[model samples]
Target: MTSPNAAQVPTIKSALKFFKVTSYITGIFLILIMVLWAIRLIWSADVWIGGPDGLIALAQFSVDPSTGEKVGLPGPQIPNDFTTVSLIIHGWLYVAYLFGDFRLWTLLRWSFLRFLVIALGGVIPFLSFFTERYYSKVAEADLKKVA
Candidate 1:
């Protein structure tokens, strides 16, 4: 007969699934932000439908509070501002990823240091893809033991 703790197998499976989904999503958004940053920093331009040349550079300028006109040479602005939206979305997704990480890590009873390392995956661009693969394998192995 299975041990009492074997019931945790299903919970572990669910937590693993949640962690995997969140890891993939967070990793994708992080990579997207990295690509966009590269475009803006390296090329000094971002894709924009309204940009005269089909691209626009991020700009910050002083504004005349009274006149409501941009001061100095007006800089280019992103017509759609998808970059900001992507960044904000990534921020929130990272939070969700953390929840998954905590849930999985808690269930598996792994070290806090390992948890911190896994957490870095959310911010380190392609790291999530790697961590997701590695840790998921580790979890699956542990799952076999539990079963």
Candidate 2:
């Protein structure tokens, strides 16, 4: 509160808006990543690029024709980059979320621990949304005090 930059109300408000948007987008992507992780666990984690049924998730095993028995290995298919693409996209989005977080944290001159907690919001499912709401209220109150 005693920081020299504390008087920069407009900058803080803009930072708050940026942080809010990043939190929401990162939260949604986090949920999507969680969903993809679950899907991988339930079926096969591997996705194929160019098989007879291109761009598909392979099962854990294949069936034997002659013996009419289940085989332990999966059928061959070209590995697709689609599975990892979403993960990469999320990673980059989280970085953007971090940038917004850092900007807000710097403007408010908050503690390092608080900054870390806010950073965690992007990784934990639904936590970003909660943190966004909580901080929006806190920032609004703080801005009012400054006014």
Candidate 3:
């Protein structure tokens, strides 16, 4: 049996809690992308660090079309050249983040423009961490003021 006015008070704890959870999830996704990129760069030297030498070597070797003989011709480079496991994980996680972002924005009555920036946090490297920290601080401060 609480009074109507009691409900009017903003609950900072709840807001902070939501922010923290979403931040953690998003950060994990970003880290995964980075890890994938590193693995691809290190293990698949023929594509990245090997540069022109690796490229040339990779291109000239193929199987003979008619005789099943191993033919040496420059073949197309791996399509995953620009991608890694990180990109795939990050992409899916980003869509999930959108749902969380919308939920939080609705809860906090945050502006659409601010929400857009938050959503864009995934594309840029290390940006999500900074954005999460900044938003967490802002939400915490707001909660304190309400208290």
Q: Top model by lDDT, which number?
A: 1
Across 54-74, the per-residue lDDT of candidate 1 in tens digits comes to: 455444335689997545423
TM-score of structure candidate 1: 0.76
Residue pairs clashing, model 3: 33-86, 59-73, 59-74, 59-75, 60-72, 60-73, 60-74, 64-69
lDDT of predicted model 2: 0.75
Q: Is candidate 1 or candidate 2 better by TM-score?
A: 1
Alpha carbon lDDT of each predicted model: 0.79, 0.75, 0.57
lDDT of 1 at 56: 57
Could you tell me every candidate's TM-score relative to the true structure? 0.76, 0.75, 0.55
Q: In candidate 2, where is summed lDDT lowest over 10 consecutive residues?
A: 73-82
Q: How many collisions per candidate?
A: 0, 0, 8
lDDT (tens digit, per residue) of candidate 3 on 1-147: 112223433543555565566666777777766764565456533223233556323222345678964344233344423333345666777776676666556655677887888787767666677777887776555545555
How many Å off is the CA of 146 in candidate 1?
A: 1.3
Note the residue pairs that clash in candidate 1: none
lDDT of 1: 0.79
